[model samples]
Every structure is written in C-alpha cells, then in structure tokens.
Target: MDEINSVKIEFLSRSRNESFARTAVACFAAQLDPTLDELGDIKTAVSEAVTNCIVHAYPDSLGRISVKARLFGDSSLEIAVRDWGRGIEDIGAARAPMFTTGGDERSGMGFSIMESFMDKLRVRSKPGRGTTVTMTRRIASRADAR
Candidate 1:
C-alpha cells in the first residue's frame, strides 16, 4: 500500500454530508477489497461519527468536517473524522452506551456503535475547540493480511 493510494474527503458539518462520507468510505474500502460486511460496518460507523458532529458539535455554527482514510497494509484501514465546534465535555460519559445529550430523541449510541463495528476507536476533544473520531477495522482478507 503506497501513500498515493490513500483516500481523503472533506465536507460541511451538515446532515447532507453524511451520504457523502458513507460513499467515500465505501468506495475506498472497495478498493482495499474488504468483505461486504466490512464495507457496511465502515459505512455505518462513518455515518454515525459524521452525524454526531453535525448534530452535536456545532449547534448553529456551520463548520467543515474532514475525513481521511488510509490503508494500513494489514488488510485494515484507519479513518479519521474531524470537526471544529463545541467539543464533548466528558468523552468517557459521552461514549457510554445509551448516554446522549439530546433530551429524548437521541439514543447516544453513536460512539458505542462505532466501537462495536470498528476494531479500534479513539476520540479527542476540547471543551470549546472540537472533536475528532478515529476508527479502524480489519478488512477480513486472508491474502491481504500477509
């Protein structure tokens, strides 16, 4: 896996950008020859991360969201989604299952879903700066693992 083959995308922190993020991840994962299930998981996890940024990161402020995907040369991929908005005050509680800041409608399962679907998950945030979510997953390819 060469550096030139990596994929990256950037979009506004809006609900509409969710589709763009999903497609970008799916297309990149396809090039890596990930299994169908792996692709779906990536798309779902990406969607959750992007959605969280749009819904929580910036309430009324419009900002840009950036996504970068790189093949780890181990039949796995790493994705990072970043936003410049109000960051999570408590990452520990925010990541807890069923813990949402949204009053009633939000399930707060975004991080949980991402953690379950991806092999690894990391989150960094500052109170007033922003949040970045990093996720990685194995491609489920026997040949590529070598």
Candidate 2:
C-alpha cells in the first residue's frame, strides 16, 4: 500500500475517551478533505469501535486502547482500533446484528454499524488476549464532484 500518512494513538480505555477517539480519527481523516457525509461516517464508525473497547474490553479494569490510522495514496483510509482486554470468544456471533455479550440496552449494533459505514471491516480476537478491529474506506474526492 502507498501510505501517504499514518498515526498511532494510545489512550486509557475509559468511557470519556470515546469522543476523543472519534474526534481524533475524524480530524486525521480531514487531510483527505472528505465530504461531510463521509466525515460523519468515519466519526460514527470510530465512535462505535472506541466505545466497544471501553465497554466490552477491560470491563473489570482500565487498559490501553490503541488506534492506528493510515491514509493511502489512493485516498483510502484504514483505521485499526485495538484493545488489550478480554477478547471476544466468538467472532462470528459478535459481528451479528443485535448480538451483544454486553447485556441488554446495548443495541448490539456496533459491528454492524461499523461494517455498514466503512468500505471494509476486519475483526481479529482471541479469548484471553485482545481484539483488533480494522476498517477502511475510500474518501469521496472533490474531483469526483465535478
């Protein structure tokens, strides 16, 4: 991949950091000058990923959550949200809509929403280890608007 730029951030897995993670990703993505809709999509997807780490990962105690983002020469952006916490036992079930081990009121749409908003989504997890969610999207170039 032709990497135009890349950034990596590590922060505490706290509920309050969700917004920080989202906004930071959005700001980094702004280098592409994506459309408003595209920016919204990126923000929403980042929020879901970060919230997952805060809620599901390290539920008993705080841990580190890492976000790595890269902008490619093709104007495609790739973001990876990683957590060193209790990993998912079942990747298939976790990705299903409304399937949440997080209990009721969660809506369980985190993975589904992330998949829908991003062009590509990949999830890797191992029980007793951690999970890393990678998502990629191609920015809508301003030239395309012409």
Q: Which candidate has the highest TM-score of all? A: 2
> What is the C-alpha local distance difference test score of candidate 1?
0.87
lDDT of each: 0.87, 0.94
lDDT of 1 by residue, 113-145 (tens): 999999999999998899999998877775745
TM-score computed on alpha carbons, candidate 1: 0.92
- Looking at model 2, report the run of 10 residues with the lowest lDDT sum: 98-107
Q: What are the per-residue Cα lDDT tens digits for candidate 2 across 1-146?
A: 79989999999988899989989999999999999899999999999999898889888899999999999999999999999899999899999999987888599999999999999999999888899999999997899878
Alpha carbon lDDT at 37, candidate 1: 81
For model 2, the superposed segments whose C-alpha errors exceed 4 Å read none
List TM-scores for all candidates, in order: 0.92, 0.97
Structure candidate 2, residue pairs in collision: none
Q: Quickly count the clashes in candidate 2.
A: 0
